[model samples]
Target chain A: MVDRPGGNPRAAVVGTGLIGGSVLLRLHRRGLDVTGWDPDTATRAEGRARGIPFPDELADAVRDRDVVFLCGPLSSLPETLLTVAKHTGPDCVLTDVGSTKGGIAGFAAAHGLSDRFVPGHPMAGAERAGLTAAVPDLFDGAAWVLCPAATGIERFRTLAALVIDVFGARVVPMAPDAHDAAAALASHIPHLLAGSLAGAVADADLRDAVLGLAAGSFRDGTRVAGTPAVRTADMLLNNRDQVLAQLGRVTGLLDRLAAALRAGDAVALVGHYQRARELRLALLDRELPPVVRDFPLGGDSDDELAYLLSLGAAGGHLTGCRVAAGTVTYTGHLSTAPA
Target chain B: MVDRPGGNPRAAVVGTGLIGGSVLLRLHRRGLDVTGWDPDTATRAEGRARGIPFPDELADAVRDRDVVFLCGPLSSLPETLLTVAKHTGPDCVLTDVGSTKGGIAGFAAAHGLSDRFVPGHPMAGAERAGLTAAVPDLFDGAAWVLCPAATGIERFRTLAALVIDVFGARVVPMAPDAHDAAAALASHIPHLLAGSLAGAVADADLRDAVLGLAAGSFRDGTRVAGTPAVRTADMLLNNRDQVLAQLGRVTGLLDRLAAALRAGDAVALVGHYQRARELRLALLDRELPPVVRDFPLGGDSDDELAYLLSLGAAGGHLTGCRVAAGTVTYTGHLSTAPA
Candidate 1:
């Protein structure tokens, strides 16, 4: 196992919601010394019930942590970061799991915390939210974009590497503005389209027949329409300009399709469909970096050996090993990282 | 089992592609005397290899059949129906599994075959097409709309009932025009939206990152984008007006969302999402009619009895029973239709 660069670094996660709770759980499972805090008493209690060390006071949670993660609702992230900055150690790095990076980056700059902050967004989520929905493997194999502050490249890179090493997430670094623009096109606009599509069938008269005959294509196409309104609104409003730009482009495409249908232009319709099919197939074949991690083997018993063999069978390559006392520490690479 | 109303009805299915091959295979499994014909030699050969009876000539295939099903591409359906009308027996009922009904219905009417033609559309499909992609249970639990000819409702009903009884499909009858409009909203426009959404991401600069970070929402939202262009184009062009209308509605909804995002109107955005979520959840909870089928018991041995018991445990109700020598004739209702 690669020893953590600065010994056993202490970490604290604020919010204890889905993203925050998941980060805390995954870090704790990887043997990191971590604590959590949430403004909501019930949420903090739930996190503690899940075996996460939770401090009732936010200040206590952040006092001496080497890294502090602010993961809360997008609207409240700036305020939460301000509070975290006050209590965290001077040398501690700060980061977030917010959906949009531009606003958070701006807030860090306004507060003169830019050098200590790295804005991040894990491109993964479930329809459900909150502490109960957190899972250790939530970020596994997912794209976790890290927009490091220009002034603190080294500090940001170190913290990013530590997080990626523990979560087994593929980290892609991009400028905050570029990341917001790309996310608008890739995520936000698609979500809005799903909601609009669902809204099209909301008419009382058409609801029954449309719902009754709806099959896989409709259901799959509109799955994101079920995302809660508050979350969707926060995303769209936060990334307003980029989301609006994407919506314009999509609107243009939809218009062309409508014109083709109106004119009964089969060739034009076929051209659009062919282009889309080719692009979608290309996406399905796109490859990403493999996930590799250091698994701390607890013992050399039969069950432990069998478990190690099973991991190898699952396309994990054993890279290095260390034998200390009765424990065997094995570092390996994993294929097909969990979602 | 429900005795064939017309006594051992013979059937001929044209095209022998995915839908046609599936229909042929399923009817053959139900002990119907069926034959198939396809213009494409390889497709016909594949169907034949799967043990479906195939006649070398279209005329021979339709000569003595009680019914003929045209299951070719939507663009070629009109011509195929015209040819079938010329070759089929005088009393034979004609039907089709085309996605768009208006054009085929008009063609049948113009050819003076309205008395024998039933326009049908089975709302089930896979991204893959042709005989190689055919599955016998493709129609089970799917909505199969039948638009009967104005002149021969009784004949059309009989044929639709037979198709549903054997395939265990939910058969909903509607006027040809109404069916076209409903399908535009429920299926055609959704496919177009998927393609358009995919088209939005086809820009060269955005392709790599968009593809890399796309999660479940984007993947599911654009799944139908991978459907073959020719088929999608055919459906859009054939039902031009209705598809155009639905596209207009969807475009308006998208425009409202774009305006809300541009204005930073969180409340408006939330309203749209809440409406969509409510509609989607309601759709998930909507109930449909139970699948009832007559499953024929094949034998009276221990294994056969075990199989019968298993069927019963799966929600099939014993409807009738008869015994002659060692063979047993038992009919039961199947609870869950296979698809």
Candidate 2:
């Protein structure tokens, strides 16, 4: 790791899983001294094993630390931030790595610590989390959105620049309300949509079949559904208003498209695809530096039905194997028996 | 190799890439004498290089083959099927692994090949394609959807059973319309959305920035957009009606949610997410057997943007060194990247 430049203040990151671990790695690579905290002992141990120092107490982690980064679940942010606020140094800054900002900002204000808090989100993560999952190059060239909570302009700019310097991420300053709304459209709603889709096909047998047939389309569409349940519930419950608003827009889009199809209006239908295409492209153009994903591949797996989860094995021939009487024998290694 | 029980029907797979190559793998594994063909000489040569013999012509491939599989671009399917229909043996059964069925089925009937054609879709494939990219285990437990013409019940069923035995996939039969509509929703529309998103961010600079901060949410939201341009255009152009219909539905959903946000209708917004969650869950529960995925890392990648552009990067993840600094360094023993 590069040595931090003179006057570069240290930052404390709480909950060193995917998000926190990534923040820690990015901060460290950019030469910022980072101290991490995770309630999960194993997760903390893993972080320690990876050579990232872990603080046992919230106060110990944040005290005198130039900035405190709350990189935990959305639901946990309010209480944890509140707890941090109680013991924080008045001059020290505080921020969060939560996806939804409005609710957390509100929580900060309710606890009378709004001036010290600046909510931010780095729009990046992978399918894995934890300290061992940490990589120093996590946030290079990503968009780190900051939603200041009535914090002074100097403080916000300082925090934002610090993020840019430490994570190599661009700073996009947004109001907490706007941040929540934007995230509802871009992130929260998508998660809820995926969860809903997963919930809809709750049938074990159907899930087994679906998982096999689930190509990129299904996988992409339902990826967010794999986020831990606690995070899902936190975002759903905390940013209820913004998420609901975004959901309404999505449903509206679905209805319009469905109506066009029902009406047999091919022109109208194509227009919708074109519009969606444009919107999606616009969203994608806003690149984010890669980071370890906060969410794990969620849901209970059926070990018995695991045999049924075939991937891309159709309409193609299998090499080194032949089938006879409905069983396959292969020349190369076989991972598992067919369901 | 498993012995082909008494006269295991000979089969032919045309267009040996992704779907076609995979079809060959499964069939060969099942002990069928599988012949392969592709218009691209290099692809055919790669198959040959890999010990997968490629027939010089379609007729040469399927002359005595009991089952003929057409696995090519959607636009090419009609013409290819027409050519095959003229020379295919009267007893030979013909099936296609196209994304859309309505157009192909319509084209077959127009070409006087209706009775011989059974439209099918193997719900699988990577953003990557080609014979060299083929895997023997591509369709082990995915869904192989078949849309049989009215008079070809027995032939379709036999083909379906063969698919099951070969790929270890579930044979799901549905009316062509249902299959087409569902494909439009699950596959076609998603592709269009991804492309649209990619298109919006076509600006190289923005793409670079957005990609760095990009997390799984954006990647999943835009995964299908990485589909090849020709194939993407063909899918949209051929299934224009269904794709357009679905686009309208999605746009409507977007609009409604936008309006709800404007109106601050928290209740409506939450309801929408709840409903979408249900739909996603329902999708997850459905069992589709015989599909296979070749990616061992499950789609996370360090150079995903480059990979999506068809750069061969070992499927996912960077094993050693940083691409950020413009050099490919091997820190440890590295396997050659996937072709």
Candidate 3:
């Protein structure tokens, strides 16, 4: 499968926004035959002006491409996936760069495209937006999640290897629902907290006073609150159940904290913060466990898939894959980085 | 009291922690006759090695100083204040560098020291701790909040001017209770959120998997979780009323957000995030309101004090002050930075 050089993907990105543009740029730089497309004319022209390879038609852009990325907005993803699927080769591996995985996973299952669909969510973002702000290194050292399906194992492995070798991203194999849940904590919660924290200060009796007093904490905490409203809303809405679940857990913690503070319960307050501090210290510790090589990519058994997903759950990441040898590599703690 | 040099007040820092050390360094660099004192023998030795002025006794360190800063831990502030006060000159302006203001403010009031006690909370911090990590620019462009008292007007102006002219800090004149509320939202909440979020992942089903997926949001949001548990607890307890109150407001916001996610309410979710986005944008915008000069520091009236607190509430900051001219200046919005 390492057929035409720079390793295995003849790819096409269907959206020219930040995520898609970034993927396109990274792949193109890696000497991959990567084509770009966007139905929006202005974006297409901008891509052209920026020297990104843009073929005239969507079908032509995707034709014969082994990897076809459907990078449309959440509202348009289902249709865009179906449309792009019509243009791609039968052996093509389909994927997306969305934050949420369940919606696309469901759409693929319903349409019987799970065999070809390898659901993905790149765990990366920047403060800026659009094609102009996209950079090739956006995915460098970032987690590019691949939610495996029952039959997409071969293509999934192929793409995961290329994602690792080409872009230097860590391939985290997860189940669709699992991806949603973890994302709710790692990615979505920041948006929720950002919105909530920023909202509280907006209603502050002294707005400038609060803002003036806002230092690195407030700035870093609310960084995501600046994300475009429509995009943030769609992400939260699509992963509603998981987001709601995680939000419930976090709010419970915050409630107990408030109670502790209200009662001036020294032990309770200290215990609450100390738990987090210790966990954080563990998470942040530099001395991680040894690398475990050759976590199998051979069989598509439920046991194998579960093991792979469990590795991700345990904070293990695929540093690289010995694809031809039918295995991947990981560097992880037995439990967490600190542990 | 520009008697010994730089700009004003022969200043002295009573404790040589991060805050005190930074103040000492900044003032010392500005050519002031500043001395440092630390009860801890090792810390005093460290200060000496670092070329920070460390007179042998606490009384000598503060002797005849026009301004004295009590920079001990929250637990030591009261006694430290009394001890330091005994050694200072009659006209000395006593202040502190604590995050929460109400405790010491109450102490000043109860002890009849309100006339000299100018409660201050410098809105600055560093990732590292102690004299080893101290830097002079820590408070540059940061808010040095001085919670106004009925009788501390003259000394308050004297110290506020030195805070501005010497260290380039903006003196935010707030009431003690108000300072606590703002600090709760700005400082304490970050610690709460960090610990809660970190705790959630530590107990994840596949700890490593959740840990693997954690990114910039997780890092920044949980940044404060790394703060020492004892200190975090003390700060929270010291500002219990305000921290609990702000925590209630924030948790209420989070609960509503979870409800929006649970209901899959598009408008509600979008509206929630959009409100934050709008406020964040407003807070982040570079174009600010006109400066209001001569906000009287001469008057200690109820109305003048209220007006000062209101200025902070509206997101207004003092760019500079004209101390001898009996006025401070401001750069603020009518309501919020966005407003």
Candidate 4:
């Protein structure tokens, strides 16, 4: 209906999980002749039951497909790609939807399909997994990172773009190693660290008490930890080097933060806060070089007041009040500002 | 109609903001004769206009009140307490709802009124702050932590239990220093870290991108940072020592984690994941300990299955299509062996 851009292109999507299925939906909606395959027949049957066309045989599914999307566990992608290459059309463009790249790219090169494969990762997912959880809008506004295969195929690159665009995602071109590194810091290592933090406190009673008091902080810090173990395990096993490298950098940062705390340098602590605040604000507004805007509180209350007042003291004015049991709180907006 | 437990005990609530208002509402609903006072007349007027009784004067508010609740910035607690002591009934049990405890406990000891003040913190709030934002169930299903003041009266502790019970919150008794340390680790330092992390990413594009990419992780990490500066500043300034101490511990843990990552020990990385898994799981069921259960992924995944087996293998599930781009997800359960 949407012009079916990749129409009549024989497409093979291996793995009918959330990402893979969603990609299939996008490609199918774009009018590409699509076929779904998975090692698990029951899962295939489940997909077929949902009215999605799933061919019985893997070879039949990929025989004429012009493009193949290797979307599954990172650990399985290597073998799956080899399997697909053996059966897919000679001119087929192969790509993957794994989060990391360097290793996968190496694997593709070793498999002699470097020219036909493009490594990509769509930075989109919910805590929930599986094809049943797939939604059309999942990738809409999500970033689809493409890492060109070492032996480049311009047509394959173009195909990669179509794959990304078809899914309503923006294509971000990056080198395989670079992409892996970026993901290590931005996603993989963060996930591991979140899981580790959650693991740090393992006592049952203490854990419950801590969780009971757990508000947003715990939630944010450990969000990626909720990913299914199978997926996480694949990422960890496949992208070990880059993840470790990024962990090194983060550890250095953590060390400095710790030293600052131990030193009782209020100024340094505030500096950290300022840095974090500036980065957050810039990210919120998409400011390039990262800037911090300074505004002053009208009265000489304190630096905190100054910052609050400077942040455009709007209808949400600061009112100082003490609640039940003498817990003091600053509440409300100013009369000059609209509520 | 509920036995108005607050009637004869003229209640003086310092810092008449959100928490204070909620406490007042519960007290009022319980038939307590409550009076509120704030440095800002408008806040007091707003409370009064909203049907919360406001005292003619601070001294008059606590003169005959049997219980007094100090609700304000942790930094201002000492000064407020000193002032309250000057006008408080000798028999009055003074308590507060500050997040930190050691300082408040010290304040009472230093001010020669150790027997009357009970320190408490309600683990509940919202991004919106004001008298108008106050709601009755603010403390529902929340934790009401009590740090018994050195000079606290037994009746004061009983009164606190009576008051917090109305909100459906389970009262947890803890020591002043312990409570301060716990809050520092669980809440204060996390906020500081989140703010600092957000501020560190100075790239405007990256900032927004980060925010956009922020699924559950960044939101949970920076959740507390989204609150008002007044509360943040107060927590930092008041609980400086304890917060710093906890930060030291967190830094140490993070250092070890970083080292594990840098060493590129897959085993160590896996160990971290395993530990995190145990900790996270421990936090879910209420029957577990409070320490390790600091954060819980409250969402239930009933229909989800981890597609881990090979094609045609037992329990194997497929996700995407082979011929067309479609998904088939497995709806089964993971083997319930503890990770």
Tens-place lDDT per residue, model 4, A45-146, is: 987786667888878777777788888877788888888889975578788999878888888788777777888787777656888887767777565666
Ranking by TM-score: 3, 1, 4, 2
Q: What are the candidates' interface root-mean-square deviations?
A: 7.3, 12.4, 1.5, 10.1
By the lDDT metric, which is better: model 3 or model 4? 3
Candidate 2 lDDT over residue span A1-339, tens digit each: 012345677778888878788888777666677788889888767767767677677778777677788988776788888777677677668888887777777777788777788878877765455667767667675556765332343355457567655566655555667556656555665564454444433322233223324566876876666555555555656776766645555555555544655565657655655545553444434322222111112232232112111111100111122223433232211112111
DockQ (model 3, Cα): 0.66
Residue range A181-278, candidate 3, lDDT tens digits: 88989888878888889887777674556776777777877888888888888988888888877776777787787778778788998888777877
TM-score of chain B of each: 0.82, 0.79, 0.91, 0.77
Where does model 2 exceed 4 Å of error?
A: A1-68, A71-83, A91-93, A100-118, A122-214, A225-339, B1-5, B25-31, B106-115, B203-209, B246-248, B285-339
Write one digit per residue (lDDT tens) for candidate 1, span A94-148: 8898889898898889889888888888888876788888898998877777765
Best model per TM-score? 3
Candidate 2 vs candidate 4, DockQ winner: 4
- Give the Cα error of residue A240 in candidate 4, in Å: 4.7
lDDT of 3 by residue, B1-339 (tens): 634445456778988778888888888888777878988889888888867678879988888788898988898999988888887766888999988888888887888888888899888886567777789999887878887655766666667777877888877778787777777777888778777887776666645666678777777778888777788888888888777777777778887887877887889988888888877787677454555655565444566566667766655555555544555554433432236
Query: Which has the better lDDT: candidate 1, or candidate 4?
Result: 1
Residue-wise lDDT of candidate 4 within B135-195, one digit each (tens)? Answer: 8778876666655432333443355445544556655555666566556655776675565
Query: What is candidate 4's CA lDDT for residue A266?
Result: 57
Rank by DockQ (best first): 3, 1, 4, 2
TM-score of each: 0.81, 0.60, 0.92, 0.71
Q: What is residue B64's positional error in candidate 4, in angstroms?
A: 5.0
Q: Docking category for candidate 3?
A: medium
Which parts of model 1 have CA positions greater than 4 angstroms off? A1-9, A28-32, A287-339, B1-9, B28-32, B148-151, B156-163, B288-339
